[model samples]
Target: MVDKPKFNTALHEKDGVNQPESFSASSIANITKLRRKQPTATELVQGILNGNKTALSRAITLVESTNPSHLEKATNVINQCLPHANKSVRIGITGVPGVGKSTFIEAFGKHLTGTGRKVAVLAVDPSSSMSHGSILGDKTRMEELVKDENAYIRPSASGDTLGGVARKTREAIILCEACGFDTIIIETVGVGQSETAVHSMVDFFLLLKIAGAGDELQGIKRGIMEMADLIVINKADGDNIKKAKLAKTEFNRALHLFPAKNSGWQPKVTTCSAINHDGIADVWQIVSEYFEMAKGNHYFNAKRAEQNSYWLTETINEQLKSSFYTREGIAPLLEQYKKAVQNNELSPFAAAQFLLEKYFSK
Candidate 1:
């Protein structure tokens, strides 16, 4: 038999010309990725509807992008996904730093997924002042939940203001909901106005606190306390149980002082030791009761509608403010006006009005 030359694709060249298959695997992958076109908004929306986490993440990244070019695509994706959203129960969880927010969320999320619920956690991490990037080191705390097939943990940087991070997060919530997460938990950075912003966006606002953190009744953040639908005292295991019980009682009394919530459901307080998975079910029970009552009273849908309106206005305000400052000729004029105001050469309000008029004149 005549010997036929074996073709070694990696070793053989096309008449002294190299083909893509001749390149190393890593190089081929890199080149292929570079050559691939980005997915269309419709494609992303379809992927999200089909429960694709990767596509959901890419869409979220697009939503969070600062590039003006991405805004149009992001808006399109959000609009398409909106019809599939508003189905999940949004739970906002917040507390002061070191209050075991991450740990508690990890436990709570696992419990939820065990019940056959898909959980999406928008864990807003405090941004580094110098680098202004996500400090996701704490993501390790949710090691178990991170590996859970039904749970999605997204750690985002809390930008300079709640407007930036919260806005992107609100969009992310819609995407997660469309991607089949039945339970959406937004964990705030645990400081500043982030809690209030989160409270507005979620169906149930949960305030997680540690025992003996202060008066527990009045020393807490009053604004957020008023917004909370439930208060959970975490880390109640071992020697902390007694203190957690006392804090729970104090918080219950504190809730009584605030007028009944518009949801017509009285806020409840409970204690949990997240490390041991203690009392975790009780917390979910309280949340379930709240949902049951809200849905029965038809308040749930009404509240979401109100929130939608609020966010619409909020987005407009943020964009208008951004547009004003980012407009051409506004930066130099703003700087001059700022220096003038600092030197007492001009009134702040007058300068602001002039800047607005200048911006509008364009």
Candidate 2:
């Protein structure tokens, strides 16, 4: 030490003082915790294949991530899981906001799991426009299902468009299937007049409706009704039973108005009280029958193959649109063009053309 002091910098340079550990115990613990939290894609895939819900949730988080790095890892995990998917029955459940879609799904999922099927539910919550924040309350709403070992519930924000949420859901289904969930349920909150995005991904589309005054037959949307393989009138308890039965009959009549579906499966209507768990078994029976018939007639695999093709095109369109809007120098120009169009300085079609040209130029 004395010889090192030959330089004589700042008088006494001493290595005599003892130093504390470079890392505290707490810090080291935290680092370990973080490392455990972020597992590798290979570990995640193995965990998922072994039916570990923790790994499933983590992989799904990666899939829903917007970070470029996370997305690449997500794609890797998805491709690996793709081979294990498609063995499950993907069911889409949608309804008006107040029609108890979550409640119905809970009851229906419980019924399914009771019949020896592993169920995974992907619930899409609407985002607030002002803050773009989601409630993510499906897990809270489905208390029993959340506790069921055989059932898994994942809630996702709908983000800006139904298409975006649907895409994430399609990916989530693959992950869940790879995890050995045989029955997949997708729940959407209040898809206005049409739920075409949800309809395209699921094998069976179940529309839930509640009994209301003059809102049954007169207020139904043709597009959504046409897509439904089964309509279940929920909350048919106490005083609502008669009204729900009437709604079911009206829905059945309305179903006949549309031309036959390509699946050659006639749409059916039933009533159930989700809160009271009445007629829940019947709903599953109908669903099971449809699956049986679909698989028997070879429509089941055909529909799934068709959906795969549809999602391929849908994904390409989504990526291209996202790329254009997120490119450099597009936001300010888009605002300027918006103002110009609003003032009638440029037509919307022309503004769109200009934006496309600018996007391509880069």
Candidate 3:
């Protein structure tokens, strides 16, 4: 028999009894000392430009924060990074629930990273009422991509946003692009108007659908289908392969009925098994071809310019609403108006005009 080595352990005395020591004040102090100070906006911008993941994450957090003080710093960071942005390809992926979005993203991200492309996935998850945070964690689902050195995954909470995207997602994209991520994937919450919001921000919108479900066409809105630049029937392996093919054919026929897109690019439908990594490259190839065609026709730059103008107007409207609603007197007045409207004592238009008058007078 071989002799076993004995390892020394620190002991602590409790009630005249010896126990293995778990923690020490000195160790806690050392940990506190080792914690890094928060980087300034300028430092974050410089660090992100240098491809530092930690700095990029910190900058995103700053942008996501609702804190009034952090807003200026976040704006500064985005402005500094704006010149470096727009160099990467932005793709939006959306689907109904249980459509294997995480699995698809993991495989898709791996494929891009394998080709030496730095990929960043911004996954918007449904928010919780209790915590007001994202509940569907993407990190655990995307195990492979989570471990990939070239891949970055962020799960954002769809906090009261009907479109299933975080308010600061656009700013986050700029930071990712500044950090040299060549491929950016925005995964929507897959409910309500989220698909439209994602479509506005991304260059390519890919809608993932499953086959064999009787309600396939019924569940997806026709508007979403029209927005899709490419439709993919995921989970096509084994028994599902035949069904997936049929669904693809059905979608192809349906797409032809819609009028041609302004970009002059025809939408394509295909099938793939995200779990088995089948047709992943074909999806990327299609995306590449779309980019090539859009750029050739100068539609890519034109679309982005339009999107910028849209966001500018959107930001102003949001800020105006926020400023008005958050005034000290607004809440009480709103409660009073709510009762009056419910009792049919005051018309909604009159109440709204009254509130606006009161707000401006103050």
Candidate 4:
């Protein structure tokens, strides 16, 4: 069993967790004091920039927390890291549950670290809130990778989203890149076909699948399959190796049937066994090949630019809605307006105008 101190030390080095010690009552108190002190966003940003893992983890926690005061700090931290961001490869991994995502990532991360690359994994499973728990368990499953000097694993901070990825996974990516992690892998919360949130934020989107899930071509709903850069058939070892090969062949043929993605990168399908660590290196090679091809075609930079633009527009729209609804006494007015609109006493446009008028009059 990995001792708590060693685990904390490994993660601390990767994330900048300062003053690592055994978790005790004093440790809890110290963290509480830090929270109470509420270091200015600048101090927090400096800590993060200095690669203080504790501070980085705490900053993410603040961003993920429900506390309104922490929102300002979180935004500041992201802004500080923004210019240094977008340099890393953000790969989103998603599949149905039991597709060996966590296992595959552990092996894949090890492979990257071995090749002198720094890897950071953000397991996004915001649906975890409904269960009040993390679904994929990346930290526990990737124990070896977690202990590696060149790897970082951050669990999904709970959020109100169908895909367990937190709303701030984008922000986390920025911070990860700023911390010098070259490969940022995001694992989506798999529950049916709603894992598309990860697709938009990543440079390469990978979909994992088991060999004989009956329907080899499990055309995922919500159009997510159209977004995949690569499809991996995991669990390719054991007596299932031949079946896995067939599955890969089936998926490759299925992929050809679809129109190429808007990015002009044709999705590649391959098979792997995460349990025995088979074909892991080949998987990384495919990702690198995609990068080279996309870079040459000018799709790589274009995709990141597009992602940033979308996030900015979406953030502004969400902020506008939030600011309108959260004002004091706005709840009652909102309720009143809802009923008026429902009863045809007012059109939605008229009701919105009235709300705006009232809000500004105050």
Candidate 5:
């Protein structure tokens, strides 16, 4: 004999009518007003200097925007913030997929925040080919760090950037520093050539690896390994601990084979368990030591100087290419030249020269 409890079906039913709540109109009007009132560059800079996260976020959005008006505003804001930037230590973290980069970042970020460091993580996510939108799932993955008061996490779409980083990541770093974050972590999308892009912009570049995966250097390129300032063998817990140690040993040996870095510092390999929060402190300690050594040798400032020059040249080249490609008569001419080249009617070099001459003639 079973007794059945009565269920209320009426409560689950919704009336075929729209309900309006108090303050709805006012809220809508206020949003409309706010949208109409774009803040000035001075106000945005002041908000950032005062550590207003909302202002920092909006400023970053402006920087990432392709709109001409937004670009002009973003440039103004960056110029105002430049004097307050460069106070933070920028660290780049990269590895192949399934290397637990998100987990490691959560643990490492918590450790830094526990020591009273204000940390900001800029995670670049792969863009969807069809939608051109970021997966934007890193915030969910780094749950612990996302909740920390001393931590700020921003996920950006990689867009068409070949390095698996957002085009405006360097500008985002400036915004983070202007907002008083002392440690900026740039997490790349773990794709080809991303490590190179990140290394150019960071003070320390870290590569995370795993163990028991056939060859110790399975998916990673040797050139990427050479760029790492610190190599960490993660997942060093339980059954994988011994394998992690062996991988660390192998990495150390391989690092020794590379030429010395310009900073005069030797790259180090260590092991850690991001899941268990083991050996995280050791990695931070190594970073601090490297900073001390590099600063003592004046390489820190010199590296930033070189990175600035590199970006300046890269920007000029990009603008020149953009201008050339977007000229009024270039698109149609380019299409014709492309067809001719594909049909073997014109050699590639001759087609290119023809296009250049046509472009210059205009």
Candidate 6:
């Protein structure tokens, strides 16, 4: 052998330490400095497509970031990635706690992976951050699916968005698609009401239900039930098998009470045991059928186009609101105007006019 460096150096030897693997104080400083420089939008998009998970994560952070400095960069990143996005089928899954939403996703994701599809699970556990919230960990529940190379699990707190789905999840889905994931699943905590956020973004929306819940109708409102492309009865094995079947029948009947979600496809309700992996294939079949029908009718492309328009309008409205609120002296004027209105010194209309006049004066 050629003369080799000493192979017996101590683990803590600074000189012998691998530079890239170093977790030293200086390493963190270097990372901070690198982040501060902030890669260009094109470079960021390229890194995301090249499968740099860190870059992808950081890109999403930039999207969700509230910082004014990151906003322009985030917009550029989205614009750059838009052409490479919207190729994947986006699915939204929501259910009350104990309905095994994560467990079902795990089983379903494994089924998709078995078929050579790259699956990405973006679980939004809105209840995770609360002071007294129960079931704070959706990721922990998805243990088996988490280990698969073909699957990506990103468990995000719902944050200020109440539907257990991140406001930025739409952006996250685009990032996932650009990273080569074919199927993107968004899981939400079901608080009964319809999750307009989840419904608006996904091509297919699924609702999960459990058996023997006396307040079955109470748990899911009509508006949400009306939006479901499919309803799955999870935990269908063991003692609840019969109950699960019954629940499916009930849902099917209830589904008929509401009009069909789309002209070509009627929502179907199925049962599954995610723990035992029972009926998981059937669930996938139903989802595939829905996709086929939707795609065949050309509604798939149309829907995405409509969603894009919605996103643009919504983004513009938000930006306008932010600009108005943060317009230099607007806040102080509004404060003074609020006191004026309270004392009947000015009407709400007049106060608004005053603010508008001051805003446009500059």
**Pairs of residues clashing in candidate 2:** none
- What is the TM-score of each predicted model, taking all chains together? 0.88, 0.88, 0.90, 0.82, 0.88, 0.82
lDDT per residue for candidate 3 within 15-87, as digits (tens), equals 6667768999899898888665677889999999999999999999999997778889999999999999999
TM accuracy, model 1: 0.88
User: What CA RMSD would you report for each candidate?
Assistant: 8.8, 9.9, 7.0, 11.8, 5.8, 9.4
Candidate 2's C-alpha lDDT?
A: 0.88
- Please, what are the lDDT tens digits per residue for candidate 4 over residues 1-362? 97655445544655555787667998899989976876677777787777677677777777777566677778888888888777788899988778888899999999999999989999865444456665546788889998998888999754566566687787888888887788999988777646656777889989888876684756533266777888888988889999989988887777887886776788888989898989999999999999998899999998888877888887897677777778899999899999999999899999998899988888
Where does candidate 5 clash, by residue pair?
Answer: none
Q: Candidate 5 — which residues are off by over 4 angstroms?
A: 1-26, 129-131, 219-221, 335-351, 358-362
**Candidate 3, lDDT over the whole model:** 0.90
Which parts of model 4 have CA positions greater than 4 angstroms off?
Answer: 1-35, 126-136, 220-222, 333-362
- The candidate scoring highest on TM-score is 3
lDDT of 6 by residue, 17-72 (tens): 55595478998999899868877888899997887777787898889887788888
**Each candidate structure's count of clashing pairs:** 0, 0, 1, 13, 0, 0
Give me the runs in candidate 3 sitting further than 4 Å from their true place: 1-22, 26-36, 129-131, 219-221
Per-residue CA lDDT of model 2 for 1-362, tens digit only, reads 35543565678667787878887999999988998877889999999999999999999999988775687899999999999888889999988788899888888888888888999999989887799898899999999999999999999998877532544888999999999999999887675845888888899999888897566964365777888899888889999998998888888888888999998999999999999999999988899899999999999999888989999998899889878878999999999999999999999999999999999999
Residue runs of model 6 more than 4 Å from their true location after superposition: 1-37, 127-136, 219-221, 334-362
lDDT of 5 by residue, 209-236 (tens): 8999864866344788888999999999
